[model samples]
Target: MSMPGKRVQGGKQARGRAGLCQALLSLLLFTLLLLCVPVRAEPVLTMGYVEFPPFFFTDARGQAQGTIIEMARKVTQRAGYQLNPVYFPPRRMEKSLAEGRIDLWIGLDTFELMAHNTLSSKTVVSTIELRAYHKPGKPPISHLDQLAGSQVGVYFGYSYGGWMKRIQDPASGIEPVFVRIRSQAARMLTSDRIDYLLDYRGPFESQVDSNITGYLEYETLATYNLYFVLSRKRPDTYQLMSQLENAWRQLKREGEI
Candidate 1:
């Protein structure tokens, strides 16, 4: 038979081993709990825009409000994202978007010369016909070539299709003048400084002050579609684009677009 002191010593040793095993099991359980838990998501996204009235503009509340804004909110909501829309002048907005400071922008037309690395959604909106705005008494321009010898004002950094490129060529004979902003161009048109202003129909109608409308006349030239542009610099760009496209389609099907 074992001595009593040896039996006592054996009992203490067993207890010590059992205590170590219990401690290790507790540590393993705690680690497993940590691994199984889900992490919280971050809320962050930047959207860029230029001040185009009726489509997008800052209201009295200092919030971006317009049809496009509504559409964007719906799409982003579906993706569990929020938009931090930044309003910049047209040229600066384009530059910021190219530099990766902004995640996405609306009202960007699909053009070959523009920053094409961006992923563009199928045309979500369509622009009314392009028009020439002039003082009440001026002759209308029926053909593109008729624009020659006329001082035409266009928004700076805005693409008016291949027409701008052609106009830029010295041999094209069209004298195109680029204004800093749409409001400035409207003012110039009203004052009869420029012979003509090339603009889309909706903005020309909605934004020009009612008092000035009597002095100006717009004639439709051509129509085009507008697209939502997504930055390629952002991760999961393809997935994001897909989500947005689906969301927009759903909205359209529901007659919300």
Candidate 2:
């Protein structure tokens, strides 16, 4: 009883609806695929350091340049992270590191006494001798007791170790004049204001060129290890430290160190 032309029109309409449903389903499937994919987070790493030559220092251009800086960049890059080196003078850097203002601090000596609990990643370097610089003709103090009566020059708030601390205590016989800057200490030693200036031998030798060497003479007396310190409270500290230690060993094996 239905007309042939009406039947043909109904068939076309049904086909059109079926095509639209298929198109919408295809779009929904595509959207679901996009939602299931993961997005990558940006890689960022913050490093803190003080001005120590041949390890971490400001070059003539005022940019941080040193062997450790280069090594840090290489290691972080391999781990898919970027290095953001922040330079602060020794005291300020220590404060910032304690406050969690920085992620890592390089060239930290093993004996640094921090108020906060800090974790060390690995031994990055070693410095032999807390060397003493004196005038060319002065007798070197080979024994700790020899320095007892002298005014020793040290960087302000710097500590060598428990042994040095005990020796340096005023209650003990030795009295030292602690200076704020390395240059100041050196100048004081040259001018005879202080009997001697104590510093790490490696950096001291590397930084003091021939022009400056004429006024200073050095003697090595103690040794210590340097390491990278991280805030123990950071959740990523342990994992990152492990990764760094592994990377460091690999680099050493590969002669990159």
Candidate 3:
């Protein structure tokens, strides 16, 4: 007769093998289940932008539509991120970006703006031509100094590539008339409320009344490259920025940018 102890040992060995096999099989099934489940993407980002019509603005139907809006959408989508745009006044938008309430800003980048808990993308978002507008009969402005002693209308909160410093200096003698919207600047210029109105020419053409433009003369001040401004307040700030840069590169390569 066979030894009972030996038989029990064999049975233990068999059970041990079965247990291990079952464990491995369960692990395989769990991994397969995980593979079958879709991986979730990062949360939708809040893109903060000012109302620069034809660049970024809410239309008559209350829907945000514009070149910058479209560009932001493409970049975010390509990077596997969904964008939710929120309108903010210029100052509020800057503060929101610093506080991480707004994840991204697509606009002109400046050293002063980048100092506020923000980093700018290497990829150029767009190029904007800053122009100074005055009445047709007025003397043309070839330089900022020419406008000295005259009131120059400028959009509030716009960096204007730090030319704002020169514009605001007492010695420059430029009395700045700050307006909230481009339309206001256009109106002020047309009605002779201000000596000159400074604005980004691209949007000013479409946003301002055509008739008003006919009566005005403009000279290009400078062109600035728009960049993607990312907030430093978020943990994934660098990662998101990298993603955006990569997406921009791919789009550029494909000529889709």
In the range 8-110, model 3's lDDT, one tens digit per residue, is 9999999999999999999999999999999897679899888887799998888788988987888889999899999998778888888888899998767
Residue pairs of candidate 3 with colliding backbone atoms: none
Model 3 vs truth, CA RMSD: 9.0
Pick the TM-score winner: 3
List model 1 lDDT by residue over 1-257, tens digit each: 66998999999999999999999999999999998999776465688876676777888988998777777887777667788888887767777776678888877455442456577787555464678888888888776778888888987766775577776777767778888666788888877788999987767668777777666887777777677787777787788878777877787788876
Compared with the true structure, what per-residue lDDT tens digits does model 2 show for residues 1-257? 56998999999999999999999999999999999999676487788877777788888887888888988887776666788998987667777777678877765544444545578765555444677789888888665667777788776646664356766677767777877666666777778898877787656667555556666777777766667677665778888777667777777789887
The positional error of residue 107 in candidate 1, measured at the CA in angstroms, is: 1.8
State the displacement of the C-alpha of residue 110, model 2, in Å, after optimal TM-score superposition: 4.2
TM-score per candidate, in order? 0.74, 0.73, 0.79
Better of 1 and 3 by lDDT: 3
RMSD of each: 9.3, 7.8, 9.0
In candidate 3, stretches whose alpha carbon ends up further than 4 angstroms from where it belongs are 1-42, 111-113
Highest-scoring model, lDDT:
3
